[model samples]
Target: MDTNHNKGDKSFKIPGDWIEQSKQLKEKFSTLTDHDLKFEEGKEKEMLERIGNRLRKNREEVLNIIKEINLS
Candidate 1:
């Protein structure tokens, strides 16, 4: 069978779930409206911080996968 079917001839192919996660993260970050981010209000800033943490974690996972594939 074709174990590399998901990758095919592409140089890289991130797992499908990472793409979904990235989309969700983008949607979340996009919700921080200017009104919600007024100076000193902090709510929007805090929301962004939380999302940023999650994004970093997800990004690290994707990077690790990419590195592994490259090393092989």
Candidate 2:
């Protein structure tokens, strides 16, 4: 599946239920803000970058977090 985007972004895909996933992320990292999790359909790279910056994590780390959250 077309997972990564053109800029070599890791964890670019937001879960189908992002509202719930975003809630989970916020709970895990209380400092995360709505703006930090704001995702545009065609702007996954930007969103992941923002999230990685806010969480002090790499793209892969953010990907794993999202994967785990989706699994739960």
Strongest candidate by lDDT: 2
Q: How accurate is candidate 1 locally (lDDT)?
A: 0.42
lDDT of 1 by residue, 1-72 (tens): 657774522333333454444444345456434432222332433433444354454434534533453444
Candidate 2, residue 10: CA error in Å?
5.9
Query: TM-scores for all candidates?
Result: 0.23, 0.82
Q: Native-vs-model 2 lDDT?
A: 0.85
User: How many residue-pair clashes does candidate 2 contain?
Assistant: 0
Residue pairs with backbone atoms closer than 3 Å in model 2 (clashes): none
In candidate 2, how many Å is residue 36 off? 0.5
- In candidate 1, the residue pairs with backbone N, CA or C atoms under 3 Å apart (3 or more residues apart, or in different chains) clash, namely none
Write one digit per residue (lDDT tens) for candidate 2, span 1-72: 775455563335675799999999999999789999997888887888889999899888988889999998
lDDT of 2 at 63: 86
For candidate 1, the clash count comes to 0
List lDDT for all candidates, in order. Answer: 0.42, 0.85
